[model samples]
Target: MDNNFLPISREDMQKRGWDQLDFLFVSGDAYVDHPSFGPAVICRLLEKYGYKVGIIAQPDWRSTEDFKKLGKPRLGVLVSAGNMDSMLNKFTAAKKYRSKDNYSPGGKPGRRPDRATIVYCNRIRELWKNIPLIIGGVEASLRRFAHYDYWSDEVRRSILIDSRADLLIYGMGERQIKEIAAQLAAGLDVRHIRDVQGTCYCADNLDHLWDYVQVPSYEEVIASKEAFAEAFKLQYLEQDPIRGKTVVQRHGDVFVVQNPPVMPLTTAEMDEIYDLPYQRTYHPVYEKEGGVPAIQEVKFSIVSHRGCFGGCSFCAIVSHQGRIIQSRSHESILREAKLLTRLPDFKGYIHDVGGPTANFRTPACRFQTERGACKGRHCLGSNPCSNLTVDHTDYLSLLRALRSLPGVKKVFIRSGLRYDYLLAAKDDEFLREICEHHVSGQLKVAPEHVSSKVTRLMGKSGKEVYVKFMEAYRRVNQQLGKEQYLVPYFMSSHPGAGLKEAVELAEFLRDIHYHPEQVQDFIPTPGSLSTAMYYSGINPLTGEKVYVAKDQHEKKLQRALMQYRDPKNYDLVYEALVKANRQDLIGYGPKCLIKPRLEQDRPEVSRKQRRLPVSRRRSAKRQRANKR
Candidate 1:
């Protein structure tokens, strides 16, 4: 048997002539043996450093047999709830069961339990009480502190507290994981790993928390919304690695201390991780069960960078990945594009080559790399920072390199772009190139909202930026003589979007003459500045009152306003219009979102009333009042 995959079974381990393993990696996903999967990267990194690692993926949590299949490792067990949070993977924003689990084999569901990290750790603790349990992933990283849990609808303690994990790594783990293995190999006690950067651990005393910045305690944040808001603001402020301090929150007698995030990876480090041998697809073992479905989107894609400094208030990037952007080398990306052409499924297309924000191939400016992203400000928000150096020359050259590959017919960038960043570029070279070759029919951009008030609440730029971007996109595509459309994504019911603001967004959509196929409802996920605002009726940073749509019915109205064309949303749209005192937008007029629910079907508007021209309806009402 080949060592193509890290041993998933004892037999595979024996094939490699190993009697013991250094780390037993457990994941909630089926073992795909690809770099796109975090576990694959960690295990491969360990293997490269001469650590014997074995992966037990999607193991049956009901018993300990699957957990012990490869036997306990000498060092510890690495646990992650796959690429996505288990709750998000299993449920929708509406708290409904998702029909399919894309990460599971054959699109199956229920392969892993809810809160898989906690469940897997419990099982490990029950079997081997002393074994080290390290937890990290989307769930653990984003939920690593006292924060909100939307599903449970409560202020939950850190995952380190609930999972009883020995160490919790946050953000990009490539640097942190290797440091961990080296320490463990050197016979350091796992509990003493509290000193490691980018990790959170539970300590029994307050001695180690001497230099840590203490936030509101668990009880304080849970009992009072004001306390929670204050705590979130402090938490948000101290997340940058360069300027961030150690944060400690008391959980009863114990303390959950989180060290500052790991420094962003260098170009060489990113290249090393990307250059490591990855099978590029799910293990051949999954070939019969239709293979892992998540691989289809990523097998041809390349992740060019790591973090986002955009600092969207509703996003959790600030809490987890940190604001510092760590990018891969152009050589590393070109090497991967060439590798994609060799795949049997190659159709001469490179699906995507980007990370969180595709256009962000470098630090916003040179100062960010040296001193770090500004702790007091955002790179892209209401206004681009003057210090922000926006250029697409490097990213443009990288795209050109990929497009020049021999078999590459097209190189499409499916990842979303930060339009503000694109607009800040010195020229339209990247813009023209994207419209001419990269765009596949329509380019999807996130304008989010048109109202400046709501956009500011969402920590987005002014509507004027979107207007400017739309004009530029059209101009570039027009110059290219292409008919590629720009599809702008909108979000409804975010903080500060009330009936009035929602109506304003509807008016903007009408003027644009575009009806969205699907609309997004602002989900208050853990660790986002928005979630704090959602739970507490105040903006954490500014201490200003913010309106949040919590009621299911009201949320539906806001969502329907965005997609008023759908027949199913007619009633909701009508109700929203009436609620906003916007009956003028309810008629058969060109600007109307929905026709006044027919006079016969509903008494909202009668035939004679409808026949009155929209321009004179108010005058007609005045005439009736005069006659009376």
Candidate 2:
């Protein structure tokens, strides 16, 4: 066993000559001591600050026995549902159980319970009633408010209230956890520690809370859709760290008070966090079960920055990481890259070097550091902000230095690149360089949808911008004599996307001679503007009523249209075309999407095909070849 890893067993704690640990972490994920894993980062950061910490990963939640393995800690017990929300990890967009758990040993399923954080906390309370409980990470952070639950198809109370934890930390949690540990060490009562930023606590009265804006009560939001939309809008706008005010909401007799977000980490602070000594792999105990599968994707990857200003409505990046970008210095990243090269199994390639958005190496503009992100406006959405700073000089320099590393063969930018932001740059050097160096034959980008109305609702650039980006990509690849293809990711059944909009996307795919292998159906997870729209049928930002496809059949039809060429999707695609009154697209014309099914013998070619012009038949033949 590596002594560098934090103690996971009582024997390991004994080996460290520790009688009691300062903190014990409970997590839903298998213990992988990598920076990408939230539990590992928090535990390692605590260790670096002179606190003895231990972790219990994926404990059996059915009984209190597993929770007793690490015993009670001296200071507090930090809990998280791993790197992802447990509900999202356990189920798919269709609410079906996933076959495998990437964060578990042997890629097995059912290693953790449904609501892992609540379950783990309950088990811990069974053994030790008054242990200081802190819940952070993706599950608690996003569910720290009264929000909609897609799986239950109803509104649920805040996770902090349901889990009965003392403190709820949101965002990346480095700053919040450090402050929290210090206060606990200084002997502050957990219940009375209410002033920490980036945390949520339940209060009995409003006397202690100041400068706070109250949203709708939980009763009102559940009873009225309009009230729910209004509450979400207020919560969404005040997420800024600099100019944000404290937000309070009522839940029955108690009030949940959330302090303003923690200040963005400086370059030095970012450097210090990533510079901690991480084992960069799963614990050796899991080697027999083939190790944790999630580590494979990030073993050689590096996180260049955090947060995103491209406010896509369906995404939770702005809600969790906040919109302000906190980036590491080039020297810090290069140091990590050197560490990666020395790992025993490192093949020459560096998998990725990015975070939320790969190219966002700085704040959105000059004023963001001082004024914070505009209250209700996006830096790059339907319309780009005039003051948006679109520079890639620093990111390009970092990539160049990484490429010149001693043992690094190739460094890929696998993270999502905001093409609209890239296109907004004054120079094309970044695009040209990415085409020549970073791309690995296919560069995937998310256009989401092409319809103007749907794109507007999604807070994405319109079809024109995607087309402009595609053309520029083609031009750059041509100039560089590269054959790299651009793979655009599209989503279906999003709010405001009716069958008409779905067919428009299908037509665009048909015109471009592309057949998508997969299509993303929108899933309304918590803490996103799109989820509010999905629940209330109203866009929270705007008071307009939006069309939502709630029926499973409608969602299936919308998804099928994106892959209309598949034989299995023929029935759904045909039905969607008929319902949209687009039967003209069902004939033998050169521009038609699919062949019309015969009434008598559905498999036979119709007379429409025989009577077609030879040129049109050749065109149809070419189309068939392309689909193949």
Ten residues in sequence with the least summed lDDT for candidate 1: 598-607
Please state the error at residue 26 of candidate 1 in Å: 1.0
lDDT of 1 by residue, 559-603 (tens): 999888888988899999999999999876788888767543746
Candidate that would win on TM-score: 2
lDDT by residue for model 2 over 1-628, one digit each (tens)? 1447889999999998998999999999999999999999999899999999999999989899988887779999999999889999999888999999999999998999988999999888889899999999999999988999999999999999999999999999999999999999999999989888899999999997658889998999999999999999998899999999899899999999899999999999999999998988999899999999999999999999999999999999888999999999999999999999898898889989999999999999999999999999999989999999989999999999999999899999998899999999887899999999999899999999999999999999998998999899999999999998989999998999999999999999998888999889999999999999999999988899999999999999999999999989888999999999999999878778887875323333356875777689668768978999
lDDT of 1: 0.87
Query: What is the lDDT of every predicted structure here?
Result: 0.87, 0.92
Task: Give candidate 2 regions above 4 Å deviation.
Answer: 1-3, 604-628
Model 2: how far residue 614 lies from native, Å: 16
RMSD, candidate 2, Å: 4.5
**What are the runs in model 1 whose C-alpha is more than 4 Å off?**
1-3, 600-628
TM-score of 2: 0.96
Backbone clashes, candidate 2: 0
